[model samples]
Target: MIAPMALARPSPQELWEMDRQHLLHPWTNFGPFEREGALVITRGEGCHLWDAEGRRYFDAVGGMWCTNVGLGRREMAAAMAEQAERLAFSNTFVDVTNDPSARLAARLADLAPGDLNRVHFTTGGSTAVDTAVRMVWYWQSCMGRPEKTDIVARDHSYHGATYLSQSVGKRPGDRVAEFRYKETGIHHLSAPNPYRRPEGMSEAQFCDALVAEFEALIVQVGADRIGGFIAEPIQASGGVIVPPQGYLRRMWEICQRHDILFIADEVVTAFGRLGHWFASEAEFGVVPDMITCAKGLTSGYVPLGAVIFSDRIWQAMAANGERWFTSGFTYSGHPVSCAVGLKNLEIIEREGLLENAARVGDYFLERLQALEALPLVGQVRGRRLMVCVENVADKATKAPLPDGVNESKRISDAAEAMGMMVRPLGHLNVMSPALTITEADVDFVAETLERAIRQVTDELVREGHRIG
Candidate 1:
């Protein structure tokens, strides 16, 4: 077993120096960071966090948009430890499966919308999405349409990081933009960005135009050649771009009409993040063929993910002469992770955290919009705990700043100095806290955000940055 971390105290300066000298962080440039230090988070509970220096602050970002159930969960720790001590290693391959794996699969089947009764486990969101992509092509092959294997994903929609998942993700973080995965028949499409809609358009008209564009893409790609279409029901990482009303439903219908399998990448939006077990059923009134989920599944206590599929796809894949599904991970269904997932679900349901997200999320959304009066804030958009504040050059035109402005980074840095951590996607400041956050906590987030934006905007105005 890997050695446990020692309970030793270290100074912030020491830790930062160690990070600079030894650590290679992901998605980071180490050269510039060598001169400066890193922010070290020490502890968290409820909707708050403490830095290495013991400064308390509200966790507005919820640790990379996970931690839906909050932190310092003693019960979760106990559950994971108990499982680890028990049957810790068991392969879910061939005829071997653990009790927790079976039980958690059944629990998820019951909770999933429609007939997504078959659960395939993985270690995290990336692998789960990677598995889903492979499964779609495999299903197409099984159905005897090898050529119908194209995938269509929306702009700025984040699926995951594995090859196929990365290819499908049109998110700004997508480094694969210049590469052509189209050799494998994967395609990208545009989404209805309501905040930045074209001139002389109402929200309803914008949605209609979006629908028409989507239909045009399907036709242009040839409906017979497209195998699957995947999306995040709320587009969390894609600037929390919540669609206008009926947007999701319309997209799902278009997929159905084109005979394309619909997949929902619910890695961030599932398990009470959207005040529902799954956001698809709540917002779109339709269930997808497959739903890839991670993050809050075990509330970040343990690493786990799942690709839930309907019986139609499951049966078709199973009844074939091929015995193996041809895709999975060694720790796909780890016993400890399964046990933690079961416990996490129990806590979420027993404590009504989903309902809390609904109630508190409504309050947070209303208050977040109040920041629009500030010059830097263009539009505040999101649903439930997932929200984004778009930074614009001019509120009247809704135009984003020039690429050199980097308003997102400036505002985020200011928030951190104010003892809060926030991240930006494009020109939008993304915020998603614990589902258990209270109304007072929500207010604190709003007030702190106002302070951060005001500070940044004031500095920019004095510096002659076009924030107006």
Candidate 2:
């Protein structure tokens, strides 16, 4: 029999005080953070995480929608170390390039769908999204269509946290007020939420209604004034909202017809999260003019992102001027990050994580759907590894619970106590476990979620909230 080994570490309270004193977390409401500090995750292995006190918990969100290959990868570390020993960094500016950057770019282009043949690297998802918006501006200006200035996004969309990307994404709270340049022309459409679909409509009809909504908005704003239509195949932070079938294709057709660039923000869905390298074309049957990806590109080992472009967009971009793009970061194509990305992709391919995601995603969704039997579960939905369990106030009317409802958070906390991690967003508990998660792992998540949901449901019932 093997005995557990103990290692000395700082006390949890000490670490918590240090984190609260120095670290400023993103998308956080710091009043509570000031009082409670943060969850100090010490390390991760496979689909599980260990906190500072060595409490094990399944990472149901894959470390904020990255970590497709899971955690504690020795080979990935070795790849980064090898690259650091050889060539750690280089400037991709001035036509300079490194082996890993060049090869990884080509590898991404080949894996991406359609004529998305060009790659522009960035530091991470936020930068990638901002870069895509800039590229759209550049593309339109090069084509002598400067009037196309407005970017069209949807409700519940999360592009990034950069200034431009914050304007591109929907609200998290009052964070938008801090920006000096107010969002003027960014248009937002209704979120494609099927669970809250209009009364008495089939899934296909709801899709048509949503498309019509977009068309009417375009007409209201005038197609000539629009620059691009940015969308996520699956809205991650937006309660894991999945649109009706054929919605993506129709939206693409409308964008093409209006001469507007189609930007697929696959920062969350790309790299096997949706059972493919890119879900826009592979799963949705439409090709985007541009796609911004990060997150799983290097599986969280290193920060990296890429702006993939179609031939049409690239041709317009190259014909603009000879004076270089005057964009990109010092670490845009850092050889070390790219080297890790190259090895990461090779690992994903060699281990067949994509295939695993496809096969297990169905099982995963099925497991979530089983929660519909619980009165507290309003709806269960998702694709592949990404799934959600929505707690409702009323199932007959599909009414949402009151704002500031804390049951979701409590349930998530309970799940963590049961050795599982989940993301709670507006009464929705979201899960996007690693692609490397097995069927047994799926069962573990499903069973733990059921227990947590029931515990919360019983409490809510006793409180007479009627949440179902």
Candidate 3:
């Protein structure tokens, strides 16, 4: 139950002024900032959100691909409230312990695939990834392999915004930019994009080529110098790039053969996003040495993330008896965050949302596939609830819309005007609604997108833009 707050919230105009005056948003280009004020979201409930002006929107993007169980779960609010009242703050720096933290750690250990039973919590996805990559250095140092100090990731992988994580992400613009950048030993391999691969290559051959590229890179980097290899099962924040089948398995084999520690950054795939609690093992058929997950961990109710390491690595770290290589956050194992996670996992299991995602996902993708009939649609691909609709000028050439045209943003605006909110990654429209979304909701979203794409196409065609 939501506790009744007696405080009067700021008006939309008031809030926007305050934000514009002081708040700088992440990933926003502020040179041409909106003078009328930003869209202020005042409240949310079950797969939907409302602006301060009372405009309701179906949140197809799931609050930046988090919000697994939708929104406004009074139980989750109550759980956090109870925990906050019980113990609001506690540092997990040293020997400190808390019930929610301890219990959530065990819960993660139980759910994590294979022997990835060790849990180290963090504030969010970026920190989790930052910590995991740093752990690779520590692991190598502890094991006396200090020469292995490099991190290899895909060119399209989205790790985090931290120095090490951002260094590895190959992107033109930041999800959130930073002044302090590093061009250290972190290297980026070619992104695995089947849609954009050379025309006429079979999926099998494409997979082999990708594996070969990774292997060649490892050789060039020198096996002894590379400490870890990381990848997202489904590359989120980078256009939801789903690689060819058997590609990840092959990559895993390559990493193992090269003695490189494999880390699966499942920040976007874990917790029912791909119809699995963990996709590193379930979807890809490879158990990573470390798995970093967040976002859906607490369903956006509380900030939390974790890196689950294998038992062997934990044992090795433990073996560093007298000496220690330490890295931790002030809110590393924040009790309130863990409590929310516990409740969120329960909701996922109790409602069988994972199974729901697996079942409804087929229908969802099918409905989305209907949009392929649209002239502007370049490709429609996704697994389970995570979907993308790429708008292209030429389907045959896979040519993106004219530079600076912002076709994706146009589609997003059209969708919003039609009562749905989808995220735009360049020309790709990303839709990852709540895992508990139904076939009806999928239809609504697809139909809205269809209308939006049609309108956007007409606009582009009239403007003399190239068309398929």
Point to the candidate with the largest lDDT: 2
Query: Which residue pairs of candidate 3 clash?
Result: none
Stretch of 10 with least lDDT, candidate 3: 171-180
List residue ranges in candidate 3 displaced over 4 A: 1-8, 175-180
Score residue 214 of candidate 2 by CA lDDT. Answer: 89
TM-score for each candidate, following the candidate numbering: 0.95, 0.95, 0.96
Best by TM-score: 3
lDDT of 2 by residue, 193-297 (tens): 898888899889989988998899899999888999999999988878888888999999999898899999999999999888899978889889999999999
Q: Lowest lDDT 10-mer window, candidate 2?
A: 1-10
Query: Global lDDT of each model?
Result: 0.85, 0.88, 0.88
Candidate 1 per-residue lDDT over residues 105-140, each given as its tens digit: 999999999999999999999999988888888888
Tell me the lDDT of model 2 at 363.
94
Task: Give the alpha carbon lDDT tens digit for every residue of 1-468 in model 3.
Answer: 864445767777778887788887876567645564467898999999999889999999999899999999999999999999999989987688899999999999999988988999988989889999888888887788988989888877788887777877776466344476667778888788888888899878888888888888877989889999999998988878988998888888988887789999999999998899998889889999999999999999988989989998888788937756488888889989999999999999999999998988878888998899888898899888888988888888998876599999888989999999999888899989999898889889988999998998899889998788
Residue 158 Cα positional deviation in candidate 3, in Å, after optimal superposition: 0.7
Descending-TM-score candidate ranking:
3, 2, 1
